[model samples]
Target: MTARSSSAHVAEVEGVRVDTRHWIGGRRVASDATFTDVSPIDEQSIADVHAGGQAEVDAAVTAAREAFGTWAAMPVKQRADILRAVADGVDARRDDLAMVETRDNGSLLRSHLRGVMPRVAMNFRYFADLAEQISHPIDEIRGHRQRVSYDPAGVVAVITPWNAPLMLATWRIGPALAAGNTVVLKPPEWAPLTASLLADIANDAGLPAGVFNVVQGSGARAGAPLTRHPGINRLSFTGSVPTAGVIAEAAAKNIVPLSFELGGKSALLVLDDADLDLAVTLAVEQFDNAGQVCLGAFRVLVHESLHDEFLQRVLASASALVQGDPRDEATDVSALVSRPHFERVRGFVERALADGARAVLGGGPNDDLGGLYFRPTILVDARPGSEILTEEVFGPVLTVQTFATEEEGIALANDTRFGLAATLVTGDPERAERVSARLNAGTVWVNCFFVRDLGAPFGGNGKSGIGREGGAWSFDFYCDVKNTVFAPHGWHAVEGGGDS
Candidate 1:
């Protein structure tokens, strides 16, 4: 066990690195079966977890359903209070959780995404404020008083991806709790330990028994049953297109309300008028989180005039990223979440190479890395249907292509079946605005890339996802809308109030 900084509020961190179980009905319980936690560094078992299944999912669902009445009936302020407590607890134990996240997820080269905590903390707090600000409608019918109010949606099932365990959880957890709903969380099996630890944080924060429950298991056995559970009122899912497609199908059986944050093959347009140096920096940074980020600018479209220079600058920037142990503060790029992810990304590169996509810079895995470390690859001249151009290579890989005009750049950027996010670097404000409007992605950054302020509404457009995940609009995703009109104590008005 390693000691943490003052914020963690603990003397030492537990390094036993054992597998995690589940949190059902407010307690840690083990499933009948278990699964191994494979280390990205050596492809060996570092830890294991209760091999969760339909039973565990059923238990979590039962717990949530049992508490849904009281939880949904609780005042919004009280629910907000519980959320605030969770945020405070997360902050209190930030460093320990960060370490565990790094250990479990094989953060590229392995960096605990704890850097995202400050924003996550803000997410919980912002949702708390938004809770108090939930709009209630007041209407006057025939000059008389009438009112409408919001209501809860019972149990919410939040299924988050391994790429960002805590941050994505916070996004859903904060709003669902604030909106007066009980939650059953199913973290990705790839990063179950950290998610279970987060459940512990909620328990310590004094969330009521069964108000928040966590289940650990695979999507097929656990996630499928959970989403299809009749008890679950809404499902907030973040993951891949194929998985999302499956979850959506199961959810449709019950006609459950769904909030999906899926994949993105986004683009970054480097305009000829942009600052070349800044453009280079933004390109690599935009693709931070090893391009695993759904919002990352994976595809780069540079104006033809600046293509050569921009390519050179971006290559140097990508080359400079220090990839190694995520725990090492000096490291910028870490290993992907697992060896499978490494292979998945490498396969994309290999397919590109097989095609005419030229290996402009890096192109494959770094054999020197004992762990799963891949060199930042850059491919140029990829054709329309190339793997590097169409699919998400969620690794330290970049693909570069040239566009003759701003229109062409925009066209190429939006040409994909995906529309998650895009960034434009241009000195001309008018040009940036014009391009931003034309790009089909949900988020468009001008002169900046992948930087977030926490308050912004974050989600995708088109295939990326449905509905927003942040800002005031977040309440709508978690809380169901009900219009209730109560008129004054008189039955004078008829259906046709015009009085023919």
Candidate 2:
């Protein structure tokens, strides 16, 4: 594989050169073992990342545990102010972070600049304010006043995925920090650079020592120790289901509460009355980020009457997508995050074709743009129970399924074991409401896709994994709720426990 120039591989954020070592106790901590971090764009060695093991995990957890009490006890206003500062820091270094993330994960640079980078700041700002404003009403019943309060759940272990690392990490980290729990984050080894940069941003924003830490390494060496560590009070993970099951088993032994946002094989349902243009746009949009998104509508279920037109439009749009370097402003698609992922996605298409599926658009790699650039694929006539149709490929591939009736369409959309999100297209308001309700998904987008509000609940169901995290839902998972019951002022206790 070709490699990018050495000069281009070096990254700097906020005039401070990016460091690949683990960040513990507000300083860079190096592990004895190390691994070469590679970029997917040209499969080039970007940096030497410290491959943290059990010792590093223990140190990070200890730092977080030591910092927890002071952080949790701090006034909400003070914490909120610190978070607001962190948000500002992120915004100031937006360009650097966006570029680094693009290099590390092969996502379009424009995407990071326009949508993702800005959202990372918003996650912190929104959660900071929300945490400060959190309130629970008190009730007086049977001469007793009852009130509930939220307390930080000690040290939280946050494990984030690579596709949208910083944004998703803050999605959980913002709330965890706002709610006063210190965090030990294990960023995906494939894209760990930006996370290392984020630690600097947090420290510069006046976050106390040991409040936020990063452990860099692969799943087995760093992730396993962090997730299973007894010092961790809460475990939050966003990744594959198989990994979640392993983390869950580890969490169970220590009785640590878990918040998981796992994999999905979500469906996009287009009714006969739907606007064909809008439906096609949404379907093709799934190819964004090279279809590495968990909420992507990979299984597109179209009404039989409009399936042909929808597929034709999708092919036209997908064919026009530019597959090249993600750093290029005009590039619409880029390489898969790694070589293994590239082969895995290619295998899905190859097996589907061999199983009698017909490729409507693309079915293999784009040789001209080689390295790991796979052409956007659209497969039809796929075997019903084939892995290509049922599994989470996490690639730029879509399988078209036709249904004759609205009932059938809904049935097909809900057929998956994963139900993270669903997209419903219909001209009728009533139909959108009814059909969306019937779709077995945690979040149902009507007409529009990827429209996210930080306040809205976001997560998955079934094999998509468990828990909702956004707004109050995030605090609910990161904090432990405590209810207190006491007698009202000057009130006499009733032996019968009934109001007089």
Q: All candidates' TM-scores? A: 0.93, 0.96
Model 1 accuracy (lDDT, Cα) = 0.78
lDDT of 2 by residue, 65-119 (tens): 8998899999999999999999999999999899889888999999999999899
Residue by residue across 65-170, what tens digits does model 1's lDDT show?
Answer: 8988888888878878888888898788776677766766756322444466666677788888888986787877665555656577889999999887877887
Task: Give the count of colliding residue pairs in each prediction.
Answer: 9, 0
TM-score of 1: 0.93
Q: Worst ten-residue run, lDDT, model 2?
A: 1-10
Rate residue 99 of model 2 by lDDT.
85
Compare the candidates by TM-score and give the number of the best one. 2
lDDT of 1 at 484: 59
Q: Whole-model lDDT, candidate 2?
A: 0.90
Cα lDDT for residue 458, model 1?
78
